[model samples]
Target: MKSQEVIFVGTRSGLRLVLDAEENIENLKRVLERRLQEAVGFYSGARVTVETRGAVVAPEWIEEVRSVLAHHGLSMDERGWDGASAGSADGGASAGREPEAPPDGAGQDQSLPGADTVLIRRSLRSGQSVSFDGNIVVMGDVNPGSEVCAAGDIVVFGALRGVAYAGANGSADARVIALRLTPTQLRIADKITRSPDDEVQAPSGPEMAYLRDGAIVIEPWTTHLGAVFGV
Candidate 1:
């Protein structure tokens, strides 16, 4: 399977899946499965538009591709390559459902990584950087000099001593949360703040940062804060 045979492309609207129309259906299935498995749950609950580069595709072959994508928790856009709703080989129309975003005003729990969310299982070292179109969850620490930027929210299960920018896409509602929130710098949307002059100390509990009156505010994360964040 060539790398170009199964490609995942990111766009302003969302993710796109480009397939080689000339490739064997079985081969495409195998390659697509392998690629989706590599990302695992990262792309789950996401809808993707399929592109075949103007090549005509057979219904059975397309069904095979759709099955593979479904196995990985992805749905094909109803308006596919030709920008029109398409039916299945059996002449049945399959509705494409967009992934649901977190409820308005409520912060999504980091435990349940959702659509467009990237889960990093390992700690980031100095000079490391991560940029994503959606939410970012670090299972481990983000060391000093590292950087993380997300279009949505940013969550660190362990210490966060590095730089973090949430709402990179200009979403003022986005937030940043960490178990130990002593970052070199933090930014939520257009608001930015740096560590205090005081020496960095361990936090009593997890902390969260969000925009307030056009400024960034850091506070201890509490269970009842759902009123502030919705969830």
Candidate 2:
């Protein structure tokens, strides 16, 4: 059989399936089924993420793809849908889903490795999406309608109005942090949260997001918290 073009990119973090945004929804469904069957068992129980690469996909189409993957015992990981941390804060990970803020002056976050860093120097407007297999640091604002997804942590030096995902590969320990954190949605590993409809206020400073009791929680950030996040 001939190989499929622009299929999937497998990275250390997980599998990034380059979904065809241009194809008709039904046709795309058939193609995805066939392609997944061909590569079945090879990625047994692996974490999978679908990327349209600028193509628009309806939620129904995505559900169809997820159905196919589920048939192959591959579950869809929606944690990093341009998400960060456990909530809308620092992009880091946890074990017991307990808040793991650095205990006051614990020095550097020995857990953060230097290898997982992706730096974006520009602002991200709506409809723009950035995905990486590591941590994401945006030097500019992440405007509403934009999204950022990563397998590790996420840190935005400016406003973070978009969605952010951290630990997309199933590591609950991941966290998300932003200078001005008013995100549309936030995710860390398997947990996700959005701001309440009645809460229209924004934090005056930076914020961190992490897991707390199996849920994502966003917190006001302090210098000590920065040190724990290795900021």
Which prediction has the highest TM-score against the true structure?
2
The whole-model C-alpha lDDT of candidate 1 against the native structure comes to 0.73
Report the C-alpha lDDT of model 1 over 12-85, residue by residue, as the tens digit.
34456767767888888888899889875455555676766545577777788888889887777655544322
Q: Give the CA lDDT, 0 to 100, for residue 75 in model 1.
A: 76
* lDDT agreement of model 2 with the native: 0.68
- Backbone collision count in every prediction? 2, 30
Instruction: Provide the TM-score for each candidate, comma-separated.
Output: 0.52, 0.54
Candidate 1 Cα errors over 4 Å, as ranges: 1-114
lDDT of 2 by residue, 68-121 (tens): 878886777674333221222322222112222321112132233225688999
Best by lDDT: 1
State the number of backbone clashes in model 1: 2
